[model samples]
Target: MIKVYGITTCGSVKKALSFFKAKVIPYSFVDLKTTQISEETLEEWLSKQPLLRLFNTKGTKFKTLNLSKELSDEAKKEWLLKEQLLFKRPIVECEDGALLVGFDEELYLRTFSS
Candidate 1:
């Protein structure tokens, strides 16, 4: 099953969920506000995508924390593990085990339309 991770208030997350609903693709939503992500899950995402990709540098949480690019990978990971809002919205676990971060309509069409 496809599982999406993000808070309901996130626009990107809303877009992703809407895409799935419009496509008639089945998916489970995991609200980041309620769910806790584990180290193993973060490690798995990092295995598929880069640490920078998983990190949300543009979000309010990042700006609020005043994170810098100089932060080490370990430091970033620690922040992500502690702060769920720092995750890029709508992290989708695709059926094939690929992790999709954020929302792009073209990419969504290509990935899910198949």
Candidate 2:
């Protein structure tokens, strides 16, 4: 099953949920607010996609926390674990071991159309 990780109120996350629903694709929503992502799980995602893709450097949380893009990979991971909002939003872990981050309608259509 596909597990989508993100907050309910985030626009991108909402779009992702809507996209799945509209496409009739099965998915389980995991709210980041209540869910604490483990280091292992994060490592898996990082292996698939770069940390910059998953990390939200423009989000309020990042600005509030004063995060820098120059941060090392390890430091980025630590920040991600400590502050969930630093995530880009809607990190979808597909059963095929694919990690989809953020909302991209064209990509989603191509991915789920199969």
Candidate 3:
């Protein structure tokens, strides 16, 4: 089963969930707001994709927190651990060990199309 991690209220997360439902895809949701993501899991995601891709620098959380774009990768990672909202929305962990960060319609079509 695919594991989707994100807050339910996020627009991109909603879009991703809707896309999955509309396509009859089975997925389990992990609400970041209520659940804590393990360091091991974060490290696993980092291994699959660049930290910048997994992090949300343009989100409201970023702006509200007044985070600097010039922050080091390590600093960003630490921030992510402290604040789950710092993560990009709709992070999908696929059955085959593939990771998808955020919602891209074209990418989703190409990736999940049967």
Candidate 1 off by > 4 Å: none
How do the residues 10-111 of candidate 2 rate in per-residue lDDT, one tens digit apiece? Answer: 999999999999888899999899989999989889999999999999888999997787999889999999988899988999889899999999998888
TM-score of 2: 0.96
Looking at model 3, residue 24 earns an lDDT score of 97
Backbone clashes in model 2, listed as residue pairs: none
Error of 1 at 40 (Å): 0.3
Write the number of the candidate with greater lDDT, choosing between 1 and 3.
3
Candidate 3, residues 3-113, lDDT tens digits: the string is: 999998999999999999999999999999989888999999999999999889999999999999999999999999999999999899998899999999999999999
Worst 10-residue stretch by lDDT in candidate 1? Answer: 105-114
- The Cα error of candidate 1 at residue 52, in Å, is 0.6
Per TM-score, the best of the predicted structures is 3
CA displacement after TM-score superposition, residue 97 of candidate 3 (Å): 0.6
Clashing pairs in 3: none
* Pairwise TM-score winner, candidates 2 and 3: 3
Candidate 2's displacement at residue 91, Å, is 0.4
Q: Which ten residues in a row have the lowest lDDT in candidate 3?
A: 33-42
**Residue-wise C-alpha lDDT for candidate 1, range 3-112, written one tens digit per residue:** 99999999999999899999999999999988899999999999999988899999999999988978999999999999999999889999998889889999889988
